[model samples]
Target: MNDALPREIHAVLIPVGSVRLLLPNAIVAEIAPLSGLEKVERAPAWLLGRMPWRDDTIPLVSFSLLTDANAQEDVRTARVAVLKTLADDDEMPHIGLLAHGLPRLITITPDLLVRTDGGERLARGTSAHVLVRSDQAIIPDLHWIEARIAQALPA
Candidate 1:
């Protein structure tokens, strides 16, 4: 077993289906209950829609949808996690992550993590290591998420 102690990640546990995801606190800006979102025509299926946030409107994507998990049946009960992402130069945009249920703050222990195996992966594929609790908590690749937004949105 690796002797390295796990760094405690102050994360927000966003429940999606039976799984609870530990998202880095730094990335999370705010969490809001499901609300009005302006649907974009011809947008990707994964894109939930757009909503007014702070000053500018932000695009939202279902976390389950992004991971290719089951589509949420209770959109009314779902919540949106606003994530701060660096844009052109040094601007930060608040992008929303649509997830089922609510968010909880938790501490992750070293023993609860495992190194990922080298092989085929899924959409939103995790890194070489993941933090697990009652369910597997894959450490997300923000760069991957950012790239997806870059491909879809204009500067």
Candidate 2:
């Protein structure tokens, strides 16, 4: 591993249904529960809508559908993992990810990470890894997830 990268990354591990995911701490701006989410009409099913964050309103992508899981019906309280994505001109911008519950922050070392294979048991754009007693996975790039969601939206 290059010295440029941190030997250990402070990651936020979140449990979504049965699987847990590790999110890079750098990109995470804040974790906030859903409040006044405005639904976007004709948007993709995975897209819950836009929510106010500070002075901006960013789109929210459901991690469930992003993993090709069945749409959850009873999500009264959602934890939004606010992330920054580079715009077309290389400007860092914010977006929110709608997850099921709270996110636990932990420091993860490279030696502790194990590659995983979800195979046909899962869908595309989903990744897995082994961390301690459980299998952890993460969507490495939120922009790609957002792009997938954007692509799926009707024109």
Candidate 3:
């Protein structure tokens, strides 16, 4: 006798290398063309560099490289996905992700997403492996990713 309608969530599917990341649309600030990046010295390979956005310079990271340390993908033609940081850090309010192309907006309902991990190990910086409709996407661990970015940024 339960007749409640399933809640729908607005989300975005961002292409990073060969993987597609599913994230809430609210967290995505902007998807801009990849521009010149100021290199960060002694930073990890996952940390691509600092990119200029609006009036502040934010760190740009390669999600593929962050998940798999050995992943190598050319970023010369990548796009920048500016994400609003969740942590309450005054110094770093946002971070950029190196996306392969423009992200696709999708509406997700409870029945539309299914957990596809199947007891398999999830990648680092990833919360879960899910199948949204016919497409498989990874839910990124944004908190963990933000912490990693904060630790790698120069003081």
Candidate 4:
């Protein structure tokens, strides 16, 4: 067996309502518990609210909104996945994903990742749709999502 392959990447499997989000461990800053959030006026449905994260107000988004599903759980029991922004803008360095529960860690190899659905159409906020360990998940388009947030922000 050749021993030149790179090490398996560590990732976080977070549940956003019914949909799962597979995110690189390096991109996720923290999984913080949800508290009272500061709601923004005239914001889109996906933009739940802003919460204090690392001395900044980060926008918390709902995955269900992107897919037209309802998975919003009890607010008192919700958690937020704090992710580092992929865009070049600094005004919003980090964004939060509303997770229904705690996120679990997983190690992944290239061979284990597979794209199904015959190249399913990826909507906005979605990048790639793949199956991880037989479970389907959508790799969010962080860059696109951030761009949407940037446009949604008030002047």
**Predicted model with the maximum lDDT:** 3
Name the candidate that leads on TM-score: 3
Which stretches in model 2 have alpha-carbon errors above 4 Å? 1-4, 86-92, 118-122, 132-135, 152-155
1-155: candidate 4 lDDT, tens digit per residue:
88886669899889887778899999999999887699989998888888998788899888778556454445667799999988765788899988887787889899888877577676767888888898788788887788778887786
Worst 10 contiguous positions by lDDT, candidate 1: 122-131
TM-score of every candidate relative to the true structure: 0.76, 0.79, 0.94, 0.88
Looking at model 4, report the run of 10 residues with the lowest lDDT sum.
66-75
Model 4 quality (TM-score): 0.88
Residue 29 accuracy (lDDT) in model 4? 97
**Tens digit per residue, CA lDDT, model 2, 54-133:** 98877787776666667573457667888877555232267777767778887777777766653434355564545543
Poorest 10 consecutive residues by lDDT, candidate 2: 84-93
Every model's Cα RMSD, please?
4.3, 3.3, 2.9, 3.2
Could you tell me which 10 consecutive residues in candidate 3 have the lowest summed lDDT? 69-78
CA lDDT of 68 in candidate 2? 62
Q: Rank the candidates by lDDT, best first.
A: 3, 4, 2, 1
Error of 3 at 71 (Å): 0.9
Residue 61, model 3, lDDT: 95
Q: Candidate 4, after superposition: displacement of residue 134 in Å? A: 2.9
- Provide the lDDT at 6 for model 1: 52
